[model samples]
Target: MTQHHQPAPAPAPAFAHAQDGTALAYQHRGQGPPLVLLAGQANDHHWWDGVREDFHTVRSTITLDLRGTGDSDKPEGPYSIDQFADDVVAVLNALGIERADVYGTSMGGRVAQSLAIRHPERIRRLVLGCTSPGGPHAVERDASVRRSLAQPDPQAVRRALADLMYSPHWQAAHPGPYRTLGDPRMPAHARRAHLIASNGHDAWSELPRVAAPTLILHGDQDRLTPPDNLPLLASRIPGARTHLFPGARHAYFEECREEAGTLVREFLLEEG
Candidate 1:
């Protein structure tokens, strides 16, 4: 069967972060209230490149390359979701932001959840995209897929991940840009570290404690986390609302950028 796809959008501006004197790199754009973005495992802020402008239209957007990805420092092992959440807190602290809306995708979503659970006062609103409640059901990625990502050959890995990242229709519609964004030279150790931290995460038990208003977005066709995860996540977080896009995949933000941005803006505005 044939599928439909949306045209891809252009990239946004780049921003640098003096994260605790570490010089972390990020992308900043948009205007209005501050909205921080977190990327997925084995991906950097570049994952948001296509959707940053859309987000900026409604609110000031900040997208970061976490410690080990993009141009950020890739320190050795012992990486935990909580530690990554601290890195996010450091970014906000360095920028003198006491509180702001937070949006996280996949691993980034995990970080956002952790931040909300551990440091509730710092988050004004929360958006978890293409994410799962970290537990048994979440650790079901195909073995071959896991193996490829663990020790990926840059080019081959990018190609392999492309299939998992976007819907088939979206892939066909914007093949060039998707391929380019996926071509970064991610190391095996870094990928493994991220996977370990993400899979080891278990925040479902603590999610009900989050006080911030929350929004959960997921793609119906997302093979990575599966749409079922969205309901699970929303159920765990009190008062959390969810939106599932039909025919979308793991990169739902990119595939449905405009819709996603609109939903997020409306949710924040109504809740605030």
Candidate 2:
């Protein structure tokens, strides 16, 4: 017999004040141990729209808009990954959450790195997906991939993003809810700031300091943050492990949502 589950409750919008007085926006939903979701570069909480439900059944999710995205304060940013991590800390403090499991993908994963490194006590277990450490030690995306992203035509850019995000087989068979791209509502300055923060991320020397158990996930076919970074992260972060979704691309969490969710759920809920 097929199983049917009721949808998770709607998230309540809330705000937390950062040290700089920025009113960061966030939402809390469901009931269970708290799990914080961080968005990728230039994105908002909506970045997880496609996969969040997979975890909501068992974990209370807290998702925040980084300083410049979603409803968060869009201050003039020369933002840093360290700063982004602090903003998450503010949200957690506001909610009285001392520690939570953190799952961050792409640029958000970079912020998660800083979070675990800088605020070690705030994370229970860490999940980094489809992201790089970002520095001289990290593998950079191919120049061709960079050129495709730099396309001037919007349609052309969309196509390029589609190619980067999903596998060819998946793209041919499915009409994707591709939430992998940056948020559209971002202003020019906010976008630039986000890009700067993402590019400037460098936690190579600090990964070993992350005390939380870490799981690094990625798609084997990922073009943006290549799967090469998976082992790099696994090797750097003490006791870190990795899982690669075969034939999947950048948005492997969405491409293989159920399986990925199960893997993460098992990892997060397991007894230490």
> Which lDDT values do the candidates have, in the order given?
0.77, 0.89
Per-residue CA lDDT of model 2 for 1-272, tens digit only, reads: 11335545655679999999999999988789999998888889888887786786679899999988889989997989999999999999999999999999999999999999999999999999999999998999999999998888977987898888887878878786577677888888998999999999989998989899999999999998889999999989999989999988988988887778899998998876
Residues 82-138 of candidate 1 have per-residue lDDT tens digits of 988887777777667899999998888999999999999999999999888788745
In TM-score terms, candidate 1 sits at 0.86
Clashes of each: 0, 0
Which regions in candidate 2 have their CA more than 4 angstroms from the true location? 1-12
Error of 1 at 108 (Å): 0.6
In candidate 2, position 239 carries an lDDT of 93
Residue pairs clashing, model 1: none
What lDDT does candidate 1 reach at residue 114? Answer: 96
Cand. 2 TM to true fold: 0.95
